[model samples]
Every structure is written in structure tokens, then in C-alpha cells.
Target: MPGQLTLQGKVSAGVESGCLVMESGGKQYLLVGGDPAVVKPGAEVEVRGVLKPDLASFCQQGEPLEVSSAKGR
Candidate 1:
């Protein structure tokens, strides 16, 4: 898992439609390419995925995380 990252956080609704915010490591990360319904607002979760630092995103959702897997923690 060269670029894989495991982060513990909570999901929040993004400013834009269909986008999600992951509050982790004292920062907010944007979640892309997954079923947003899998996570709920303010619910604690752990996400395993690759970081797409160079990916473009809307709002101030920090970096983009192309999540590979996620679950309630």
C-alpha cells in the first residue's frame, strides 16, 4: 500500500452538491469517487485510501481522497 492512507475522522456535508468532507488529523479532506451515502454527517469513521493531492476540488474541503474503503469506527 505505497500510497495508501488510513485516516480516522467524521463525515460532513460539503458546500457543493454530492461532495463529502472528512474531518481528520485536524483538517478537512474531500472524498471523491464513492457512494457518499455510506458515510453520515458527524459520524465517526475510518477511511483507507489514496491521496490525490493534485486533484482539483470545489470549496475548501482540503485535499481529495480517492477512498478505497471506509467504515464506521
Candidate 2:
């Protein structure tokens, strides 16, 4: 089974209407179909989910893992 990964970062872009982008450790990740109430750009958050090997590929391929949860870290 895939293990859960937790990352703390700031929301870079995207929105609650659909997908969102988060930046952590100088890297950015696309948070697809996420809740807007849970996060926003410049807000610090802890995201829990399985990490994908190809970050860029996720958008074109399968839907990324659903965000298990998001909280202010």
C-alpha cells in the first residue's frame, strides 16, 4: 500500500473552485480538486497524501491522490 506523506508549505496558486498549487521545500505541487476552505495562497498548511513520482505527469495522466487532509502546521 502507498504510505501517506505530510508536507508543510504555502499555497502558491490555484483555487477552491477546482485545483490548487502548493509550494514546500522550494518545490511546488499541484493539489487537484481540493477544498478552498482548507487552504489559500501564502497560507501555511500541512498536506497529507501519497507522493507521485512525476509531479508534472499527474495533471495529464490519472487524477492525483486525493488530499487526505490539510491543516495549518
Best by TM-score: 1
Q: TM-score of every model?
A: 0.82, 0.61
Instruction: Report the backbone clash tally of model 2.
Output: 0
**How well does candidate 1 score on lDDT at residue 71?**
82
Put down candidate 2 lDDT per residue, 1-73, tens digits, no spaces: 3687677877665543345677667666776545667776777888887765555542433325457788876
> How far off is residue 40 in model 1, in Å?
3.3
**Candidate 1: stretches off by over 4 Å:** 35-37
Report the lDDT of model 1 for residue 17. 73
Native-referenced Cα lDDT, model 2: 0.64
